[model samples]
Target: MSATAQALRLWRRAEEDDAWRLLRADNAPFAVAVLAEHLGGDDRRVDADELAEAIDADLDEMRSYGHDLPLNARGYLTAWRTAGLIARRASEGARGETYELTVDALAALRFLDERESPRHAATASRLASLSMQLTQLAIDTDPQAARRLERLRSERDRINAQIASIERGDADDALTGPRALERLRELLSQASEVPDDFSRVRAVFEELSSTLRAKILESDATQRAVLDDVFRGVDLIGDSDAGRSFSAFSSLVLDPALGSAFEEDIRQVLERDFARELTVTQRRRLRGFLDELKIRTAEVHDVITVFARGLRRYVQSQDYQRDRVLRTKLLSAMATAHAAAQTTKPYTPVGIDLELTSVASSSVGALRLHDPSEYDAAADITTHETAAVDWEMLRAFARETEIDFSELTANVNDVLTASELPSVGDILDAHPATQGVASVVGLLSLASEYGTRGDEVEQLTWITPDGIPSSALVSTHRFTERIP
Candidate 1:
């Protein structure tokens, strides 16, 4: 394309792009700040309610500072969603929804991060890394055997010379402090892009999945072929270009030797005196980089697997055909309506009154059982004079019916004060259940509020009211610190 044409194309694309739109939005600073604060770092996704609560606090703070943010957090979030900056998804195996930054929003955030912490374009470390990568690429891709061999021999000679110099006690060959910091910063900057890259990869798989489903829906021939492949146990999504690329990335991230080396390097770097100059966040990211990468890689793999299986199941079932039929009926109705609109006035009422579909009517047997006490009232309800309160009797009644959570709380706090994380069983062991199973239930409730749950179940033993030993297997829970 010519320069003007190419420039015009790029300008149109920029106008349409969500990242570009986010950067140039009216409340760009406010939006970006809120999004980065909530969705950045390890908390890449925040629960919908939690995100709203956090942003609501931020809005209040900004409003106190004389900003004109009239809408609440949910309202702003909805607007941002419409603008394609944020996305909401159902949380895995959890109630309610979660909000995450869209791929474009992640890109914009990354851009802002890089802009804030500017890296020199031509730093020595960057240049050296690029040069080394290019040299390796050249050596690996060279077609001529002689040229490749020559490059290999030259590399071997350089390594041998380095070994000889190191053997001569050339400790001065180590990188200077400044140079090492520069390299470390460069590595971190590069590492920062990885999260965005993973987001993009996931987006690509999602798009590819949609495209495949669209193809199936649009073409009967393609549907048959896809079904045949699926029945043969072929993974169409995994065999795609995006899938292959992610597969390679997953393999690299999961590699044991590479992981070990990366971890060791991080440990060595952290131990260096120069590392003290690095921020806590930088140090933490470096330490957890490999493990996080593996986790993200596995998550992406699961996404691919889920999409593939869902697509196959969609095709194998009659859902698509039913949907196709529904689509046809809706379109036909639209056409009929259009035709009628040409002849009849829009305000004119039709003869028919449409009723919406609803649940089937059932007898009162499905309703709650009626209680005479709930509705009954005495014909003459005489009021009596007030009397002195019976505190001891009230206490006896409460002790008989209530769970005695105050006692349970004391038990839990006593156990937690001694142990960093104590389970329900631990609390019971430390303080036997005074209220029998009621105390156990109360302890579990307290644990649910303040403790972390484990996968394994543990048997909680307690003495019954009659002094018989009672036990029940319950999911393990651990508490940290005293529950004040």
Candidate 2:
């Protein structure tokens, strides 16, 4: 299935079972559920164009957050958005699709994760109460009141962290990422007596939340104004003001006189720094994907370079070992997988070993010494397989073209008119560089057919020059628009 469609399928699966209810409560869960609701059924069969647009918009939204929002606030928003539960809507005119709250989004609110579903409703209500209490604390001004406010704000953070952990899987590193306040709360509550771990957890959360909250509230109007802009798209605009005076705010909030000195000097300061760097949720994770792509590209390139060096050394040394060769090959394959990601895998080696014929996993074996035909066929197979990989690489390179040509859009459009083969010129028209580029486009079309779950996006055409074909050149775009 296409990414959107597959996501839609996942959402439906969750919703039909009443699981989607938990998603709408937060941004990440909302994104995932939103995708499902927007593209459910026929939508799960979203066209390539829509997928392209959704991804672009998501990236754009994230960029805005990073440049404008405070690091701490941005981190929280990112968690909420990347949960991938929000429904994406296709915007009219120049705009593409956007995330809109939907039925599935509501389901996200009722999120009953595999473990947290039972407490979903109860936890949500408690969270609301804690949020209110923190607000009250923020307004209070007495010296004793400041300490109590810090305690309450820390509690509120713990609750928010717990909700976050439930929406995202445990692999999300909720403990390190967001202070694991909620988990720590449960940990403290469950213990018979106050253990070192429990005390440590509370101390850590209290310092982290209070320190960050104070910095944020004390932030100058310029910073606060930027903060307001960061959360402009999101509805949660907590008391914001331009040119707001915050000098009255005590620096002691972060560098305190009353709180734990050791905790303040070492842990609290470090914790504040970490919290500030945390990425918040945006309307989409499009920017995250782009950053990931850049990182992944760098990693893949390094691996490939290492492989080339290894191959050169091994070939020169003539110290041939099957295990070593296979290991190199495996690393090379993994590099390709990382680079292409969803693209068709380049090669599936079938290693043969005479001694270990019983082994299902292929091993190294020389060709039958006397069979010429078998040798020729095997050589042809190797050539074919090798050629396919090169083609895929070229396609990937070309696709990193001037624009991120949406695979989703291409997949949705290409196969609408099956049996009508696009001409050489027609294919070339979409991309006009060289024969190599043309070949890549062809492979891309064919790849989309196999990669996508359904045949709607798969198109095949027949072009007979002298014999006189029906349609001279029907581009994939035209194919999608055609009523026939």
Candidate 3:
């Protein structure tokens, strides 16, 4: 059969499948809606407990509306998985299986939730998109250089005319009122879909990685050939349509200057009269949509980076050489076995039984225990008499007294009271070191509590009792007098 006929047959079978029927079921809409609301964000996987928590309120509402909803979310998820609408897989290092909406299920959910009448701005934005896509297609497929050059010239002329209009302070070309709202709506829709795009891109990278790993293990190809195939697969993933789109999206979203400009533009747009007409929920959504885009883009970039690192390690370690060696050994062993089987008297395999004893068990009877009676309980006790403490030595050991921080604080207050605004040096000069370096530390601590005025520096010098000079460099301290 032709590939087209096979595809058509498969499509027809899918249309009549139990999964498709489940999607069309009466309760499917509610179930899908709940799933989308919960697992639609950066988190693509939902555990049983999380799924239950997310849909409990929605299920209750449905029950109140006289619709029967699934009480056990885990069972509901299992049933969907059995029907091929959802996928359940063991989560890495996690106890329970994680559930994710299969591609088909997501498509079906999207179809069901699609807007009957899309936002007003969607029509014009779609037309612009279509025009852009057509232009790209022409540039890609058309062989006429003159026609492409003409198109470019026309575009440049249009841009020049717009610039001239702006130079003349013309207000006619500016977006406003309903038109501005439509554009804003279009932007919001695009931004909201970015997370979904990221999820799809990440899924593709994971699938590619799995395929490369399986090929490396099972293929009987040469080491160099295997390595080449792996590298080619990596390149294809990085250069594929989805990969290219994600690269462009991430570049734009991750640009520091562009991100800043986007935020500033959003702020200015939100202040306009047309923006004021939007509902609070719509306004909030627009405000946070760019932030969500940056976050999702970062996550996708991180996942791609990790996958690339693992791929590089696999290639650098020459793992394919080991796989090729293992394959050769297996082939050689199989050939030897086949040759032996064709002999007049084939080597008969026989099992041999040998008794073995562990060293611990063998030495068990040889171990001798010390007689308990030989070890007297009183003989085991050894005690030393406590020595009497000398009061003079104890007093000498406790010679160092604790420095009082309160005293340091009071002294700083006194100096600042007299000088109005004293630097750290001034405070230290007013209070001589009674506790050596510790006293200076206390003064600096008190100065820090009062706060510094600026980046001005002050040097404090003090002499220890041993006549060693010590100095401290401190920022200019602003001392405020205590009110009480």
Candidate 4:
């Protein structure tokens, strides 16, 4: 492509990409500060409400410092979510939803983080790490067994020499001062990218799954091959580039030996004298690096698993067929409309009237501002002398509310003596509900625990304390004997 063509493509991408859009936003600095303060550290996700409250407080603080933030936390969050900088999802067993930074937003945050403290392009620790990886890759990939054996022998000899020197107390602590810090920074820099990688992998899987669904809904002919492959247990997603890469990464993360060694090395590094020079955040991050990697890796693994299963379920349930039909009808309608537009203006009145679906929308200016004073109660209280406790009145009140279980048990037993497996209605008929519905309710409660209930319902009638007749259809319960 020509330079102009390439530049146009780059411009288009920048316009579409969320990370670029976030960076180019008017309040980019404000958004970045809030996001990093709340969710940029150990917390990958925060409760939606909690994040809004936290951001609201920060907004107040920033506004006090002469920042031009007019909107509240919820307003900013809504905008950011709509713009795809932040994502919200329902978490399991949580009271409300949670918000997390999307992969693109993470990328934006990472860009800003690096800009503040840029990594050297060719630092000694970075170069040495790269060199060691390249050497290992070359040795491992060597076609000739003899060459691989020779490389392994050389590595073993070097290790032996190092051991001999260490045994003779001639080895020096070269990684003590500045060198240790450099390597630590390099490690931290690399570790910082892992979370973004996991997020990217999850995003790729989601997009892939969506693409597969779209393909499935294209047409019957297109779906046949896809359905056949799916039915035959072909792991289309797990076999994909992103899926395979994540699987390998997860395996490494889950490896017991690798995890143990990584943890031990981190501990030893943190205990070193050079670690004292590191900031508290850096030290904390280093200590939890392995744990954080495992968590992120597992999250990616879960996303892949969930998406794969959902895709399979989507296919098996034949939901795509309905979607395909809907799509076809929509296209047909659109085609008809397009043809009609050629003959008549859109505003031209026609004999046929179409009802379109719509949502309720209103102007923000129409909303009424809440006045707390309007709802506040400001009545003064008047003190009165305490009345003497009336024991008889209290007992009468308790009798009215409390269920008379003994009377209900006796009624059940009396009814049972006359007939075996007497239903609740039979017992109520024998004892005319002296306590009205309360007595009936007491009997039903006892029957539920000590007797059997049937699907059949019977209308039981009773007179209330005010002599008003009342009736209700309740499930039939039979008692075989007197309540114990």
lDDT top scorer: 1
lDDT leaderboard ranking: 1, 4, 3, 2
lDDT of 4 by residue, 248-297 (tens): 88899899999999899888888999888889988888888888888888
Tens digits of per-residue lDDT, candidate 2, 1-484, equal 7999999998788655323434333444434533443443222224435554554565466657763322342343344345443334455335544433333333433343324534334454356557877767665644687787777789789989888887877544433433444333332233212122222322333343344333434455335432232222211111122101111221232334433453344334335434444334221222232333333334333433443344333322323334445667888988978887676554655475457556354544643347667645444334343343577788767544312334423533444344354433344345442323323344344433433222234243333324432222233332224221
lDDT of 1 by residue, 189-275 (tens): 889888878888889998988887776666663245654455335689999988888888789889899989889988998999899
Off by over 4 Å in 1: 2-4, 7-11, 331-484
| Candidate 4 local Cα displacement, residue 182, angstroms | 1.0
What TM-score would you give candidate 2 relative to the actual structure? 0.17
Question: What TM-score fits each model?
Answer: 0.70, 0.17, 0.54, 0.70
> lDDT tens digits, residues 150-254, model 3?
888898998899998888988476778887877777776676666556656677878877776666666652343445534333454556576688899879878
**For every candidate, C-alpha RMSD to the true structure in Å:** 20.9, 27.7, 23.5, 16.1
- lDDT computed for candidate 3: 0.69
- Candidate 1 local Cα displacement, residue 453, angstroms: 61
Poorest stretch of ten by lDDT in candidate 1: 221-230
Give the Cα lDDT of each candidate: 0.85, 0.40, 0.69, 0.83
